[model samples]
Target: MAESQDELSYSLKREAEKKGFQPVGIARITKSKRIKLRTDALERWIEAGHHADMNWMKAPARIEAEKLLYGVKSVLVVGLNYFTIPENKKPNQLLIGRYAQGNDYHKVIEKRLKEIGKWLQTKRPDSKWKICVDSKPLLEKAWAEEAGLGWIGKNSNLINSKQGSWMVLGNLLSTEELIPDKPSESLCGKCQKCIEACPTKAIVEPFVIDSRKCIAYHNIENRNKDIPIEIQKAMGLWIAGCDICQEICPWNQQKIPISLDPDTQPKEWILDLTAKQAKEWDDKNWQKKLKGSSLKRIKPWMWRRNANYILKNNKFNSSK
Candidate 1:
């Protein structure tokens, strides 16, 4: 006998938990008003050029689940808490975003998702499943909210009331029908801490970030292009990606559960890197240190470029 939707949803959540994904929830595929609102917001964001040079965000598949996975009936969203409070910073240390401090979450989460896919195959041999991490063309954050994992905070990061905004999200689109969870309601209210805190004012409005002005975007995705003078001036010591907005969010300030996954822990080598080392690293050095790290997205030249900004800033500050 086939299991009911409620029974299947409960079993799926249990299975996901066993695979190390916490706060998992299911969202049935539907063209609901909330989904339409999210799609419209994404269309506007892209139309406004807020996605920067990431042309992939403009893919039609991003707005339509069936385009990527035909007959996809549900999305199982999961959040892996990657939050790790940094150790005291030593002088001259270059900062890498907390998410990239450990192993690449794309690899870690995709591996777990693949495991879940295999588990699902046993239950429904005829069902199709697609695993997606950050690289996929899916509206993962919106689906996460739809799944009740978290609401998109003012910083545009998914903020779980219990887990905070320090999670990396992954999705599993499957043909299996599952009972959907209620969507999360935004809790940001009128707080403007993230907006007031941004050095680049990247968050032009609440829950909307302009990637052209985002430090993380320039450092990680803007490849080979000269960072705008205004952005360069605000770069500070961030060599790979910036977290100023998340750092200032009250949701992130709350007592949050840190990830216990060994793969998500901060690497001492990454934590100890300095601007000097970054500027001096040869291609060989870059390949070795950044191996298996999400920071590898920042090319050797990009590293030098970002590091030079930090060095220049330090000199300017000291001279003052």
Candidate 2:
């Protein structure tokens, strides 16, 4: 007879895959021991000053992650593809990572997770469940790596041999026990493209990134009145997020592209806006052009700041 637990887990994975999540895996939250180790790593990483200006990276609130899956016997992880087929869209003309070009990923992932949770309830009526996306302090990438969906790469982003790190990850921790999957081994091998491609050299060393110097960190997290002059010239007009590391990663070349939810696709105006045109953009037009999009993080003023920065820096190349 097929084990009831195994059957239910298989069903859960199938449901998630049908919903267009590229990869799905199950693992137990019975990993309290790993929690302590992660905390140690977190403390050490912070002490080494790699986290940079993101003070929240060292927040005490992360203690909850130690027990995020407590009383839960399984975690169902889902990975969704978010890549756009176009290569290097209007480069140096101001860019946001494909992930941030659409609606906020937290909302997108949570919508699908709720459906999975409801389906689980139908299957395991007595079980309790909690869901989370990147919004939480949980060591989600570590858990995903342990669940066999992928390996943690040298750039500190998770990688699947077939698909790369351009996907969003989500998980549901449940009281229902399920068959657990094994962890994946590193597939980065000797590759270091992501490290060499970083404009800010944020990947200070293998598997270690210095967030303070990262372009993504600056464009998204920083509200400083004056960005570091050197960094400002190098910002290259990235208003929201950066994808240089992932773009240079070899794995992105291996996979067949997948369909994305239409509503989450970027508007045409995103690529059409130029450094010169963006400076004249009004708030109302921006609101409509970027409706429901993640660029809302780069508020009108911030986007203008980025556009102006790009215009100023690119002026040196006008003769070309």
Candidate 1's residue-wise lDDT over 1-320, tens digit each? 97777887888889899878878999989998888988999999999989988999988989999998999999999988888765898776778888888899999999999998998888788999999898999999999999999898888899898888888999999998889999999998999999999999999998899999998999889886578888888988887888898888888888888777898899888878887788788999999988999888888988888888777866633211
Q: How many backbone clashes does candidate 2 have?
A: 0
The global C-alpha lDDT for each of the candidates, from Candidate 1 onward, is: 0.87, 0.76
**TM-score, every prediction:** 0.96, 0.89
Give the top-scoring candidate (TM-score): 1
Among all windows of 10 consecutive residues in model 2, the one with the lowest summed lDDT is: 61-70
Q: Which lDDT tens digits does candidate 2 get at residues 1-320?
A: 43399788888899998887877898776545654665677788899988877666765646453366556777888887787667455644567677876677788888888998999898777778888787676677777876789987878888887777878889888988789888777888899999988888888888788878888777777787556666777777676678888878888777746546664576677766677667778888777776777667667766777766777787534321
Off by over 4 Å in 2: 1-3, 32-38, 59-70, 87-92, 316-320
Best by lDDT: 1
**Lowest summed-lDDT stretch of 10 residues in model 1?**
311-320
